[model samples]
Target chain A: MDIATVNALTYEDFVNVLGNVVEKCPLIAAAVWSGRPFLTLTALEAAIREFIDALPESGKEGVLRCHPDLAGRDLQSGTLTRESREEQAGAGMDALNSADASRMARLNQEYKERFGFPFVICARMNDKANILRQLSERCQNERAVERARGIEEVKKICRLRLEALVLTDAANKL
Target chain B: MDIATVNALTYEDFVNVLGNVVEKCPLIAAAVWSGRPFLTLTALEAAIREFIDALPESGKEGVLRCHPDLAGRDLQSGTLTRESREEQAGAGMDALNSADASRMARLNQEYKERFGFPFVICARMNDKANILRQLSERCQNERAVERARGIEEVKKICRLRLEALVLTDAANKL
Candidate 1:
């Protein structure tokens, strides 16, 4: 869909397509829908990013919590929203051997214990090796840094989702 | 799936299948899973109801908030969880005429404005007339009454999901 098509969307159509762009936080899309007729797909994403950044710290944590843990129970259960399952599978999460799966679970748990939110990365941008390494390394960061890190990763994921949903000029990858 | 099969599922698989039985509040299933080896499908539901009943008022309200409106945006956007889509359709929610759809949307907005949560009914159990009537009548309810009323509907929905998942003897409808 082009920016014109995107700008033409009714609130309901826009939310349905981009609601999960931020991973179960359609409220973001709902909140940003009022900022329609975006000059470019970039502006639409910027609006979403602003909405997320404006949330209180607890609200930010809540947003992160909305995300399923990578390779976690939702994946095992076939309960992942279609977008998440595809992203995780793209990163080879679905093919983890037992030992690696157990390791990922442990790291996810420990990270959540320390930071009170899941360790989020743009699964489409990182393969199995990078995701595991980041989880291990980021465990040592202060809560403040980890929180920002998670939010930034959320933006990365958000951009990829937007690009997939909205067409842009060659110079501006939506 | 039978009672024996339910009892045999590992925690992950159990949660995956039943996680959404309570709409988006998988935490309820996660909480109830501690009481394993349910002797009958009834026992499993009883365990779930007990857990829900134990939640404080705010938690109960949160559970209600997790529900999509009866014929609201998620339906328009195709974002309703599969279970919800089916439930609403089962009750003819998807077949609303323009007049009724607008009325339902107006009632939904009014209900939320007044009560801070969507007007909820077990769609599988109530067709359009009954659902609309209940919404109108229930709008006049005290918050406490509506709260309890909402929880009861959730339980009804829960029971249907449970029965659909777990087969039982003729004497015990799961």
Candidate 2:
């Protein structure tokens, strides 16, 4: 909606309105709720970003871990969020053949073994080949480095979600 | 440094050895080559991670465009090898901030003008508050989806560059 409308929203109302932007990380939106009366969407986005950035490393890891793998269990079991499902499909992840899927599974296992978390990437920005390439390449990184990379990917997913919510809300006059 | 001797190479030789795991992505070595052989490291790390599933999107307009604002110039400053710089830094983009970076730059400008890129999340992973959060967030996207998500983040960067000479040379070794 308009800046004035968002700026005036009640904390509960605000959370209900835009909190799913970060997948399971609702606290990010909740934490920034009181910072409302935002002069612009930019100001509001900044507030939310600050809250996430200020979180402890454990918190960040929690956020990264919250994301589903590119083509793992979530896809097979139909547990991925609609946004995630669509993003993965857009990246051509849904098109993997059995052999490629098997390879992907192997890489996924190897990656988790190496990095201690599921492999996460903004699938919306990738093709299946590139995603697999990254899965292989990043598995070789140090844990700390991979953790940072994972969080960074989380940030991208969140940003896209935020844009969709805010603009659609604004356009619809929600 | 043949594959047979790779198991016995000194740390220095190991870096000199399979260093080019990916064709063009050479910095993987400069960054972590010192870790060496890895025969024992993996065993130790696995013992430590019997712990941690993990943890855990955005506004419109401003959010999509947020990340393009970071100091991506560091990408072109030659401070980051095309590969190493892309991952630790963000989306594999160096020319993102440059107006003349490519046709992608043009689209990025048009995107901002139309729906444009949004500014949603903070770019840093763990906990630093930079207004460039969205900029960094977009950078986190895989080079592919990011290409469609915006020019600023392309997943293509993650693929092996496949230098014909190197592959042929390696094939000969095989």
Candidate 3:
């Protein structure tokens, strides 16, 4: 959508746009949409602040659920939108060979067995090797510890995505 | 302190233990202290989740402020406890050579100039060199973009610290 069109949206329309994704992850949806109209980029940030503040406690789990698994090869093909899949895996996958892929799969299984969820890490800055190293090390954490760490990683991912969205919207306007 | 001792704390005492640290970063304080009488480690986790959910919109900046500058070594000494310093920087001043020091200073200045605030990264998982590399690369981001990224990093750090605290408290009980 055009920046003007997005900017022209009423608060309800804005909220509705976000609400479409809210069920996929309500806390993030709320965090992305909960505040007043964002006139400037700064105001948009302030809106984000308001939304994060008002998010419900239960919403954190939803945020956690939105992340793709750490192993680039393991995520369900259709689970993430095309952009998200590219963002999470494209760079790292280029560097991974067959051995790395197998190791990642094994680690993924071990991590899920230990934590009851897929291993998640913010892939924006990490390369394939670094991610594999992290996965192997993190799998050693106790269930409780790993769970806490996983949630934190999810929060990081959401914040990055939010920023990207805002920036993209701003660039489109310019 | 023992879990019992922590449990015995009045709200005031709990606040005191956290000290001015929380006051300087109220969102983090809220996240740390929420859902009190934390019995199991999981209970503490629940409290942090509640705190993150309950955070005020105005508190986002405060939370972001709590992070030490990514390349500002002086702030690092003050921002992290001694143990954290060793873990993040690998042996403190002894570990910092002249080349490393200059790189950090340059990166620090460049980052602040570009982003308005000090550069912020969750250093828990990175060593000095890696952090310096990240600082150098991220300093290239435009102000609005980097500000958003910095806030995201701060959120990650806060999440990690909260988990560490809960795990430490749980270990104390055993």
Minimum summed lDDT over a 10-residue window in model 3 chain B is located at B19-28
Those runs of model 2 whose alpha carbons end farther than 4 Å from true positions after fitting are: A170-174, B1-174
Candidate with best TM-score: 1
Stretches off by above 4 angstroms in model 1 are A168-174, B1-174
lDDT of 1 by residue, A61-114 (tens): 656767788999889999998889999999999999998899999999899778
- In model 1, which residue pairs have backbone atoms overlapping below 3 Å? none
Candidate 2 lDDT over residue span B1-174, tens digit each: 222343454332333333333212122222233232334433212211111111112221122222332333334565543334544356324434444345334433443333323222223231222323444455555533543453222112212222222233443332
- Global Cα RMSD, each model: 8.6, 20.1, 20.5
By TM-score, the better pick of 1 and 2 is 1
> How well is each residue in B75-100 modelled by candidate 1, as lDDT tens digits?
99999998999999999999999999
Task: Give the TM-score comparing model 2 with the true structure, all chains together.
Answer: 0.48
Candidate 2 lDDT, A90-149, residue by residue in tens? 997778899989999899878866654568888777778898889889988988898788
Each candidate's lDDT (Cα)? Answer: 0.79, 0.51, 0.52
Weakest lDDT window of 10 consecutive positions for candidate 2 chain B: B47-56
10 residues in a row with least lDDT, candidate 2 chain A: A55-64
